[model samples]
Target: MKEYSVTPNKNAEGWYVKIEDVAPTDLYSKKDDAIAEAEKLASNDTPSRLMILDENHEIVEEKKY
Candidate 1:
């Protein structure tokens, strides 16, 4: 299974949607935008998981597809 995650940037000024073990390709200014992109990626890749993290880098929500 693959995994995707939405996490705040180091500066907490942007969000990133990343695939497990891979570098993020883009930065989103809004958390919701990052989450939406991650969810779409996870759902398209069945048997994948999406994790949403807060500014503190703690997992706040998770979804399996």
Candidate 2:
């Protein structure tokens, strides 16, 4: 199972999903959306960006999103 963190930023412009040292991905939506997106993107990776889990942050559930 993978882990992910959801952070709300007042100056960040939108919500974000941080997966540790990795570059944070701006979800530009609510926290739930960010988590859902992260979970969906976790299994898929791309050169432009990567979808991963945050070992430090606790995602709502251990399984699924």
Candidate 3:
């Protein structure tokens, strides 16, 4: 049950879902899509945390699974 984060990618454009320290993957064209995917992944491991970040790289919301 690793913690996950959905953050915006400034360089490539789009959002990314990161699992722990490993390089973030699961790029999405929209922030909502990325958040949804992150939540789904977190759901598999109950009680995991999913952090959603804004374009400025600041955390805007946190979803608990």
RMSD in Å for all candidates: 0.8, 6.6, 1.6
Which residue ranges in model 2 land beyond 4 Å of their true spot? 1-3, 10-13, 45-60
lDDT of 3 by residue, 6-33 (tens): 9888774898999983698778998889
Question: 1-65 in candidate 1: lDDT tens per residue?
Answer: 99999998999999999999489957999988888899899999999999899889899999999
How far does residue 21 in candidate 1 sit from its true spot (Å)? Answer: 3.8
Of the two candidates 2 and 3, the one with more favorable lDDT, higher being better, is 3
Which digits, one per residue and each the tens of the lDDT, describe model 2 over residues 1-65?
34444555655445677664356667555556776776666545322232323334434344333
How many Å off is the CA of 34 in candidate 1?
Answer: 0.6
Best-performing candidate as measured by lDDT: 1
Candidate 2 colliding pairs: 3-54
How far does residue 15 in candidate 1 sit from its true spot (Å)? 0.2
Per-model TM values vs. the true structure = 0.94, 0.43, 0.85
Model 1 residue pairs with clashes: none
Model 2 poorest 10 in a row by lDDT? 46-55
